[model samples]
Target: MTPDLVLYGYWRSSAAYRVRIALNLKGLAYESQPVHLVRDGGEQHGADYRALNPQELVPCLVDGGQVFTQSMAIIEYLDETRPTPPLLPADPAGRARVRALSQLVACDVHPLGNLRVLQHLVTQFHAEDAAKGVWSRHWIGEGFRALEAMLAGNVATGRFCHGDTPSMADACLAPQVYNAVRWKLPLDDFPTIQRIYAACQALEAFQQAAPEAQSDAPAAS
Candidate 1:
């Protein structure tokens, strides 16, 4: 069957993972087109994919004539277009809190540990692969420390990041937690994050969006 929606992404890309989770949560049917970030010198940089996204980023959503870039924007678009379940809160304060939690990881933590940045650290700065892993771990740990405090300290936090239901924050967070797991970053001190990760993973949406379940994921994951 021809897909109603299409997503371009690499298997393990955190940003792509976020979009997949959001699409799943919204019960939106979509097709996955893998853009191997490491193979053939990065398929996202190719002319064809570049035509779709000049930034060469993953998780570009194409629905008919419309094309959406950036994971957060696409997820928000989904939330706006499909309001049955509603990812954001109706209240302005609640929406702001959800967005802040989402940005805390997506902006503050993810940038320091993104794949391209890690590759650049090795290629440009002459850092070893181990050093690159350390860099990722360090930033993730720092961000989780703050996230832990925020989630644990706030009364607004519930089963998920914002409230009982999954929000944009949970969609943003689950992917970063996957990255942390891959890097073997310690989460002993961040019990709140650990609990949330466990809860999110239990859901079908998060499960189907996981890298191991993706069609393009490498064998023996």
Candidate 2:
């Protein structure tokens, strides 16, 4: 039987990781269609995928022939369609806070460290791997510094990014944490984030949605 939802994404893409977490949280079954971002210079650049998403970005969700782009938008759509186990808070203020937190990572942070941007650093500016690592760590650390403050100062924070339930913010957060670890950015400065990340990792949904667990990820030796 075919699931109503189909997700197009690469295994390690933070954007796609957010969507995958959302789907798992909602307990929605979906077919995973792997888009190899680096193989043969990116399958996303091919004609068919570009037709589906002109932006040629991963984490494009196709539902009943309607295609949705952007990780945040896709997660919100899922929340709207499947109200149980809601991703956003009920109150307007809470929703705003969650959105703000989510955007802090998805918008302000992730873009600087995105694959294309890193590739462009090499192809355009001749940045070596060490230079690229420095660039990524700098931006990720900058973002994490702000994120740590926000989460630590806010009373709304709980076991998760929001009132103990795994909200959209956590979905956005987990991937950024993964990126931070991948870039070898020291996480000791952000205790709140570390705590929340530990909480998130304990969840089955997050575990299932992890990059290493994705079908397209290379098998361990």
What's the count of clashing pairs in each model shown? 0, 0
Which 10 residues in a row give candidate 1 its minimum summed lDDT? 1-10
lDDT of 1: 0.91
lDDT of 2 by residue, 89-157 (tens): 999999999999999999999999999999999999999999999999999999999999999999999
- Candidate 1 lDDT over 37-155, as tens digits, reads 98888998999999999998797999986999998999889888888688999999999999999999989999899878988897889999899889999999999999999899999
- The CA lDDT at 152 in model 1 is 99
- True-vs-predicted CA distance for residue 23, candidate 2, Å: 0.3
TM of each candidate vs. truth: 0.97, 0.99
lDDT of 2: 0.96
- Candidate 1: residue 117 lDDT (0-100): 90
